[model samples]
Target: MPRSDSRTRRSRTRSRRGVPLRKSLMVRLLATSVLIAVCSIAATAWLAATTTSHALRQEQGQVLARDAQVYDALLGYAATHRSWDAVAPDVASLAKRTGRRIVLTTPQRRTLADSAAADHAALPAAVSAVVNPLAVDSSLTGGTGATPIDPRAVGPYRLTAAERTALAASARSITGCLLKLGEPSQISYAPSGRPRVTTESLTAAAPVIPDVCGGQSRILTRPTPTEAAALHQLEGLVNPCLRRQGMSPIRIGLDYIGPQSIETLYAPMDAGRITEGCVEDGRREQLAPYVAPSALLFVTGVPGADTTGFALTGANAVRIVEVAALVLTVTVAAAVLMSTRLIRPLRTLTEAAQRPDQARNRVPVSTDDEIGSLAVAFNDLSARRERLEDQRKAMVRDVAHELRTPLSNIRGWLEAVEDGVAVADRPLTSRLLREALLLQHIIDDLRDVAADDAHTFRLHTERVRAAEVVEWVCAAHRDAARTARVALTWSAEGDPELTADALRLRQAVGNLLSNAVRHTPPGGSVEVRTSVRDRSVLIEVADTGSGISDEELPHVFDLFWRSEKSRSRLTGGSGLGLAIVRQLTEAHGGRVTVSSTLGAGSLFTLHLPSAAAPPLRRDPAGAAKDRRER
Candidate 1:
């Protein structure tokens, strides 16, 4: 149970660990950008489909209207003459006029004036019921006991009577290609025809003559009222034939197939947008000649328009669309994934830069790219740091050796003084006292080095006047400069103001000046200069003294190190002068560097970083304290 509790605690702890990808800036940006891309694609597709549907419907309406005009003109021509032979020739003329068959059927359901084929058995059923009524009805009308030929005859007879009235109203007394129907209960076939006086009954067993209309009267027209405007719609979708004489029949039903719309209806093709809309509107329309339908004419009543019908309904367009959408989905997914993969490494590198203890300890990456190069560079840096640590250790050893020699001499002189080995008033006694002070100063310098390393070297860091510090150091060093016969001059520029511990900065600057004065031969001059350069302030101490050797130049600031320690016997100076200079300058967030030559003497440059003030921070030891307390 304890172990299980520990596991549960670990899981709960992980839930609170750092930032999650869902919360990260980069992840949120990635998701938002990808969603935008998806929405743009879908919206564009809908707009394209809507626009195309509107265009096709507009163009279709115009084609259908033209076909109607042609059909009406042909009928007018046939009503002027009373000949059956004339009907075919006129029908053939009209067929040539609109480049489509002009079929005429008699009331007997027999072919009378067909422009194409008399053998076509696909005559519409509604036409057969009207134009070729039952033989029982025919016998009933003529039988003596059967329902008398009364004017009150209704049902089919009433329907026929209404049509006859319409036919009579259409007859032309004055002929300039007009319809004429004199004898009733009949349908005639004469392309250029007049009303027949009373023809012998062969097809309909009576001296019953048909109405002469538009050359040949059609009791049941090309398309019943049910098929009126659909014929034009069919013409609009018709395939174009330059000859305009072939039967490119598209039997449009709920389930009928040929080369589908995308395959043949259009001339040139683009698979870019195949299936436009869905089966939410899946109705079939027999647009027999959808291509260049100007030559076709269909006289039909509007078939009950299934407005739900879609033009591109076949599996071909749907398949194409499905394939395109699938490819698009995959492409989008792949692009997003690839993009994420590319950024993942960069994000890792950024995290590594922020938390370098984790970053630098890892092995160098293996890749032939810039990121791999960066890893190699980091490895080189880590190695360099290790070497510098080794150098710092060597410096510590060197400092100890330098201090031990002076300390030993100081201690031996003190022990001898206690034992009264030296005679009273001896000159060596004065040197011995000075040496003891040097030893004490060196010990203090070592303490400063340790404190600097620990970052616990406290300073009353604040804004102080640099001019005041410089003047005081110069005044204190007046006696030494006079003893050395060196003119030590000081100058300040701008405000000579800076933020630092005043005492520390004064000590550091004084060390540089004193070091320069010590090295200068008699008549040699030391000048202290201060200036504000850009955002940083620079303090320089230059002298004409025997300069440092190239070999010892770099180690000038090392603790307890001095090129000429014996030269400062009167002042009882410690080799810690330059070392203290470096520590104090650094504590103020400034650096001290020396430029020297074999004979031209040294110039120490103090470069201070500009800062308004240090940021307020909780003591770094706070976290350690908390951990210890826990």
Candidate 2:
């Protein structure tokens, strides 16, 4: 049998499986807080960005529509004052009091002049490029020949200046091509503020109004009294800026819907024949972005815009992007740190656990968190490692000590004979042979420990005398007791010939007898007894020798365990003797027990499985040989 590596295997398992962890409580709490805070901030920022963009676009649209309204009114004022030189001068105040700008364009689609806003602001390039002032080329319903409206042939648009020019050019061009100054054109008027077109009263002229318009048409748009009142509201505004020009009070058409509905008013301008110039300009910054879409007007005329699109500003989008980027950066950093904090302690525990030496194995998990709990576990592992380590070292030291004595005796005498110090013949040879046999017993004891884990252990069951075997062991050891000058006593009850293995049964009893003789002093006594305890046969050997200490009693049968200060020291038997006895007994489905006092006597007990019946016949001579050798 080969020795098992149980100690090493057990050590490795303990080391690898049991390391403590250490993490700080405060650190864990802070990490948790950071995770929660970052998520909350990110969520809130997303919601805020979405909602704020929506609200800003809503507000910007309203502002754009209001601006469009002002443009519409200014065109009305300019046309109304173009006819009467007397009343035209008075209408200039309307432009000055509005805190805004105005453009007076001719019916021929020429800019007559401007109030503050247009005069100071430079026209956007896209607006400057809008040469087709009469944006529509058709008559009331449709047109044929060269005057047929081609909706795809839209002219340039004034986008850079927020299309102030688009407003002027759209109204000027549309009214010039579709309406007349004094003749009721094709447009049908609506009364009581409900505006509509009077298509029957319209006519057309070709040559599409030169560069100022796409064509010339006279379509009267339906005007209302409230629209006339809305036009009257413009009377006081245009004169302050236009009176010096000697322009006349002009006839204008106004369209209105609902009392509070928005109105569009139109006036005519003869820019080429004006006594003094009327000019319009615009802010470049406001119109640059819309250049492409605003250019869609001339071929299609002015679309009735009511701030048609939601205007979410670029600045608002930029802000949201910046905020989102910050949140993403913070979240990534937190996740990295969190994973690190979580994994650090476990790595330390792993390294510590891989160590082999009990003294060298320790985990540095001194934390107040989950890692701390791991630290505690590591401490437990360390203690267990220490215990097993001590047991291994002790077994090695004791086993060597037990084997050396008998081995040395054989080796010493053989060396003496080789040196011619002692004769290697007869009695000397017999003494050497006896010493060799004792050494062989020690080797066999070691083999038992080695084979303990193997699966080959089995008993050869047979029937033999039981009570007679006990009696015979006592008699056999009596000669050895006489040699030691120790009295050997024997007793038996229920003297029946029971079923048992003659050899193994004798071996268990002989071991107990030898243990008794080994521990007893020269004058001390050895006693062997047999009885049935409960259902099993019992054989015992008690000795008046230095008995086992209470503390060492439990470990008496451990392989190679010994306490020279206790009973096993004087027993002079390899400690494995009792261990082997126990093994053989258990192989027969039996048990062994022991009791002792420190300085008085000790009792060793073996309980064998009882046989159903005693042997009917037994070999007297063979049984006597076994009993005599007991």
Candidate 3:
């Protein structure tokens, strides 16, 4: 009774687990999809709100890199010209290329050249960079200002054609000598327009020649007359200035690439302060006739955007929010459409399942997706249920008919005795007892079938030698086999130890043995054999009997089913033996199978898992109870 209640509880539990408690599928799908869309939209809006200024600054950085080249071009023009008077065209070109307004002015804030009309009020407040070729304000150098002199415009120090030819000849002579001595030499030009003699073999001994060819110093300064005159004037201006500052006067070197590049008479670091204003005055005084005066370049947009500004505005923000909302709505719509399509089949299945008559209902599979696969599975389940229902009905009728015959026989005999129509003698009493026993046997078999279907059958599993079970079953059925005039034999080979329920195992094996012995004709043989095969224990019963036909073989394990559709005890017992055998075997996690020929013989094999067969191992009662609980 407890086992029956457990089975009922399990059935209810399974039914409860199949249903879910929450919103409907469509609502959940729409909620999840809309949430994701909303999160994405919110993230986009947040990023725009937080990073607009940073993005604008990054864009400005890229513009700065691009305009660095244009700045350098304009600086070169300023370096080689006398003033910004003719610079309007160049400034306009630079503005066009860089997509920015360009304005040039003197250090005194006087406008020099403007890409647009001279409207100083429209320009930005700060200067972009200074344009000074002589005493450069390093910001305009673009990090390549190793020398203050613009390398492209090398004023008076630039090499003439004759000077280059003379230098190249000298370099070739050095190259020839180095090559002869198995060394390397090349002539390269410096940005200052000086020929530099280069050699790969620094460790080699120098050739016997003039110091100019292979010397470490590459610059050979030959100042022009104009440069000489400028140097004299610069020295004259620097002495008085230094004396006024109370710093000692120092000797100067004029054979330099630029006006500020003075070879020092004192610490070079100290010379910067002494020559600060003096160098600027001297370079402009020297190159006044040669190049333009220093000017400040400014780049600007409209008045309000003098500084960097955010890219997002109120209208843009509204548009972004609108687009985000539209996306969320579309996503929700898609989720609803998809969920509706997906749940249609499930609803059909649910309706069919709710019907009282299940034998004729099936779900239609329209697609090959997971939902469609579920529909296919539902249809298969419905068909299987129909077949089982038919089998159950037939089994009920068979049980009724089987009990009716024996019951009628017993009742008739009793009634005859009661009416004094017949004597209640020993032979008559024995016949009545046999009829009662047959009824008892049918009832017991029906109970087993019910227990098996409910999955409440108990198995007291333990380590038992399979050979012992076989011997016990064979011994129990030995007398019956002898009475039927059939030879009963048993044999065992290999280790046949396994974990199994001993009473259930015996019942299942005994059923096979009994069936085999009954079917075997006189002078036939029934053998019970136990062996180990592929980590499993096999208990087989072979019989030389009236074997079953191919068409009727598959029905052998059905409840109360017989090959011959009759309840004749002479040819067939109550046909529940094989069914009980299968149920008990499966309850112990084992399998029973049969092979038969029409007339030759029949073999029934029981296979049980024996992978963990240990010698002298047993399951305690506690462990068995724990297993049952699990």
Candidate 4:
């Protein structure tokens, strides 16, 4: 059971692994493109949300300040207007200042004023802040450190000349104290002439006094007159908001005081439910004339999420999906197109390859790529195979033709003597014997060709002088040349040596010599000569006989091919001698070439590589000149 279960599990695993790959190339490519696009789009969306969310979270203080400025502007506009008819310029001005699209709508969601008409549909109907100067919104009241204060206005705490001078003396004293304690300090002055002891590291310093600075570590200096006037106006607005909230009036110092002292009075206490909206409005009313407002403000980039964080809206998500679909479509189209082009040629090649042997099928080369080259090579191979098959059939016919004549002559003579048609005389017996000898010669030549073809022929290689081989061949064929009434002569030069099978080399040369002698007419001359050229030994057999024609010369080395078309064996020979010579020469890693001119005779040259380095021969005249110069 366990073994069967394991086998089943393996099969299931294999099936699972193979399921995805069974799809077509178009499906696979489209699926892969869609997968990648989805992943990329998702990753991009996630990364965008994460980065923007973290950045917005870090700039919470800046966001709160911008919100406060916008609210203040809106609140001022609402406080002055009986209706929103003249609010367009205000909305446009705020939008330009804040780099955001701004819109004003009534509580019933009716559009009143808009900075960008096109963006109106896209914008959420949720109000960012209530446009009531009498109301306070908690969203607009808090800041990063204390409440958001205008840095340019110092309020009642603005420093006088005497106060600045006093603060400078104190700063110098603090610097001395810091130096004594091995801390860095510098006296930095505000534009309002308030002096301060500052340090680069002190920006991160806590509010508590450090003993190193003589226990007088303070960051704030006295405020300017502008700040003092602003503070007076803010205190008056706060009392009215407190009164409306049913809270007792609060008193602020007419004398110069730091902002920290003033914030401590109002920030901790919530007067009443009415003041929840009232306090925020009072703060905005005090600072409304000072700060610039933004054009638009809101945050939402994630779907089904809050407006304050990164949220993807419906419209944006749809656009992304459409783009991904387009990418997938293009990818699938390209894959299908390329695969189709590739498969067409492959199909043609397969059909051609599967053709029957007799059909001799070939594919057209239509391109210059790898597939086209493959088609060309296949066609060439087919042509060569067809030619070889034809040659094989012709050779069989020729072999049969050669053997028939000799056998027929021998059989005819013997039957004549036996039947009493002719007497078995000496001349008749000699002719029969000659016919038998001719048959044996033909058989021997066929056997050599067969051995060479079957790779059973071998050579015994040795160093041989070209001149010696030529001399021996000429001597062996001298009698035949005499009998043919042809003059035979030979010469040697350079004493060139070759590594070869001596018997085969001699036989190859003898065939050429015999052919030359046989073909030469009466008084015609046959010459054998040896020389060295191009680091090879050359043996030339030139005959002043009936030379081969240009059209017939190329077929000279083909088996059973002869210049004479007649099937007369006595005149044309067995037609295997030159073919055997070619086989033997090739076995020795050499080649034989012939050149002929009509009525001018022929030259056959055997080219063989030198077996050993030869001694250099120098002219005696050149040697003498060198010696005289020395």
The prediction achieving the highest TM-score against the true structure is 4
| Alpha-carbon local distance difference test for all models | 0.52, 0.53, 0.69, 0.66
Model 2: CA > 4 A from native: 1-338, 353-358, 364-404, 411-425, 453-456, 461-478, 481-509, 521-544, 565-571, 585-595, 603-630
lDDT of 3 by residue, 1-630 (tens): 357446434443443444242434445556777777777777677757655755676677767765676678877897677778899888888877766777888888787777766454666677788887665555645555444556544455445677667656655776776677677767667433445455664521223333434542232333434445545666776777778878776555433222232212112344775565555454445555667878888876533344565456565667668767876677778778777887788889789879837456876666544555566566655655666678768877988889989999999999999999999999999999999998998898888777665555677888899888988888898889889999999899975688888998898898888888878889999988999887778999999998999877877887787766767867788888998887776665667789999887899998887847432332334332222222
Which candidate ranks first by lDDT, i.e. highest? 3
- In the range 265-318, model 1's lDDT, one tens digit per residue, is 222222112211111011122311111111222233223334344455344356
For model 3, the stretches where C-alpha displacement exceeds 4 angstroms are 1-333, 451-479, 494-506, 550-554, 587-589, 608-630
Q: Candidate 2, after superposition: displacement of residue 278 in Å?
A: 46
TM-score of 3: 0.48
User: What is the per-residue lDDT of model 4 for residues 11-115, given as tens digits with 9 covering 90 to 100?
Assistant: 434434443333444555566567767766776686557556655675565555656776666765554444567778877787677655666665665667777
lDDT of 4 at 21: 36
Worst 10 residues of 3 by lDDT: 258-267
What clash count goes with each model? 29, 64, 2, 22
